[model samples]
Target: MTGRRIVSIWFPRFAMDRWRKAHADTDDGLPVALASEAAHGTVIDAVSEAARKAGAKAGQKVTDARAIYPDLVVEASDPGGDANALMRLCKWARRWSPWTALDGADGLLLDSQGTAHLFGGEAAMLADMNNRLRRLGFASRIAIAPTIGGAWALAHFGDRSGIIIDDDALDGALAPLPIESLRINADTALLLRRLGLKTIGDLIDIPALSLARRFRKTPDATTNPLRRLEQARGRIEEVAEPLVPQTVYRAAQRVAEPVLHVQILAPILADLADDLCKALEDGGRGLRRVRFEAFRVDGHIAALHAETAAPVRTPDHICRLFAERLETLDAGFGFDAFALTAIWHDAMPARQKGLAEDEAEGLALPHLIDRLSVRIGVGKVRRAVAYASHIPERSVVWRPALEEQPGVAAMQAPRRERPIRLFDRPEPITVIYGTPEGPPKRFRWRRKLHDVIKVEGPERIAPEWWRERSSVRLRDYYKIEDEDGRRFWIYRNGLIDDGRGGPPDWFLHGLFA
Candidate 1:
């Protein structure tokens, strides 16, 4: 009812992925067409606007497109590249308005009410957008209107110079547009055309009951043309497709000129960090990880990344963290602008911090640990406490040094008592002669044979049958002392003289103090 404002953005060659493939080395001024390769024949998926002007249409076979122009280049559709390009456009469009939604695969919709004044005015904004896109080698069509639907209709079918900007001329502008401008599926458009309703105005004038009666055969068929027309005006709530999966916590400052020197970049970087910290403070949140993206003039980007141990919002702390990473930035050619983004962050929970005078040695220990980790590598300086499980392989586990150590009972809950320095894997030994239940008087380990001097009891231990009952074994372990006062823990394999195999295999498992 009041002054309505909208912007429709079109990516003309967005669907013609074949043109993209054929012109991979060069994507400019090429006649390109995309086709769906199937059993019947390859049908045109999409064609460039230039190719369309030369007589190309969807559903036409590949042979048909080539028949029109022998030099026509063709390729299969790449849905992924199209999707990625759409997302990048969405991110770049954030410069225009914060609220921008993907119009479809090849277009975007912007609610341009009071926000159009930001780029001088709606006309100037549209001109600026078109100019920038042209400079970047992309041909785009932009349309502004009183409603999203009207803008879409005008952008796709109106005069190439731009269209429908007057406040009071919305209906007159949209009146002549065809029904296909509503962006319905191909089947719906064909059915509407068959019923002698080729334009939106024709569908709007049709009686709802009569139209419903005529198309009652198909469930997906439109029954109420008038009601659908009202919905087409974007009056109802429409879910927007977001470009990014999550909301980004970011702050950036566009430089007046491309900065080539590090001195020029330092203050900007510090200022951006300060601004981001303020934003985090406003939301009562803190940052754990942050990345700085340096967008160059040539479309190449360099990124500097940093992480923090605790939730930090102070500008000084954040700036210091980025200091080391900033050295990694490569200012090839020149960087035009810098943008700071925080990836993994969390809210600053209510916690206690000791007063400056009463604070103990907390900062010192953390600083020491960080330095050690940087020098020795993060994974090397970790706390590892291996446990004693009935299964030898499950005996030991490694815990991160940063994590709090659990109670002794939690660590001691293993079913078996294992030696502190147990070899990673047990080694088999050749014993001259030994009973299955007794210790070996002499054994060969690593080809060196030693005779046993003192012998202890034969404690029996059985394998857990629940894991594999068929392959279970009973072992008789002995604590024995050799001739040179060298003590060893040895275990006899299988049952005591069951005659299941030859003489039992002796395994010198571990060494004693």
Candidate 2:
């Protein structure tokens, strides 16, 4: 079978390169080395070509290297910065292939099966990539093979740096490489070396069963070697996990001149919104969250993000939301490019409009909520949702208005007389004329006296025995109205003398409009 083509790009001095670029302004034409802390002392992690010529090498102790060459420049290694720089390069590589991914901290893998033709075939693509990296101040060794594993091994171990198109020549090409190219453990490699099997060709003729039995003592001794062998020979599949794009729907444009005024950005954003909405419509999807980014000429990026209450695909609506956020974008030194992306989306198949006019009106509330949410903030608008608890306060939850509501099966049983407003914590009240087990007749709350003129009977609600122990108090709630027509939901905690605690306390829990 014809396997997929893979390209591996390895940056041998990735960390050192990034460090040098960060200090480019202060860099003198001297040898430099990056040191990482080891158990014994700081060890050289990477060395510049000049440093290597000056008798400095990786793995050498820093103090010894300094003694050898006192003028050698040393800086602490930054592994994280290297990884981030590699990822940024991966993103920039999307111009060549969408399936580019980081192989390790120092390398990248690009599945270029059908993409090489776009850049004038495999050889041209390799040259193009090498030239681009050179322009970016990165030195890369690139190799192309029919398999990911083969490409990776060739990039790091083989003498060749260009395309390896003849699959039949793989064994011959890989035979002369050291046994360490198979990615086996140091112990296994040492054992193989001792046996005079110092190359992949030395073991290929041996029976698989014999190899397994001979190396049974080593962890994954048989499987690891055999798997790498098969992978290198293209006998087994090598799957590439590509990086996930930040957005599903994205449109970006680079302008001939940088834009400084917010008014110029408005038109550009509107056009991007139109393009994004069209793409969403084609995909039968709608956006819930959208982001607009302005990449400034000075390397600063300004972004504006907005959320919608419902799935939306109209350019007009999207543009209006972005207009509200345009003021927040700082066009530092002017923006060179504009990008609009749909960060979050949902399926929104087209539907026929309702026959009744009220049906259309029903949608207005959600649309209004979306607009308001964009203007203020999503957290500022909330909607009540039924929760799965029997306790009054626990029975309902308040969530962001734009969030998808829970399904019916996930909600608690319908409540018969839930109050319009519930207090975060029940307020303590002083009851003057109420029986121990009955609703209060007169109460003083918040420095005001209330004479109960109308009263509803105790709706006894037991505590959730499954979740909490029986020692928890039960509540007998009463709906009472004051002489001034103010309504309150008061509950008596614990039975009058149930032995759970002191005499039950009267608390005002909720208010009804």
Find the candidate with the highest lDDT and give its number: 2
Give each model's whole-structure lDDT. 0.68, 0.80
Off by over 4 Å in 1: 1-4, 15-31, 48-56, 67-70, 165-168, 207-224, 234-239, 242-513
TM-score for predicted model 2 compared with the true structure: 0.47
Model 2 — which ten-residue stretch has the worst lDDT?
A: 405-414
Off by over 4 Å in 2: 1-248, 298-300, 352-363, 402-411, 446-455, 465-471, 481-487
Q: TM-scores of all models? A: 0.42, 0.47
Best by TM-score: 2
Model 2, 292-328: lDDT tens digits are 9999999998988888877888787788887877877
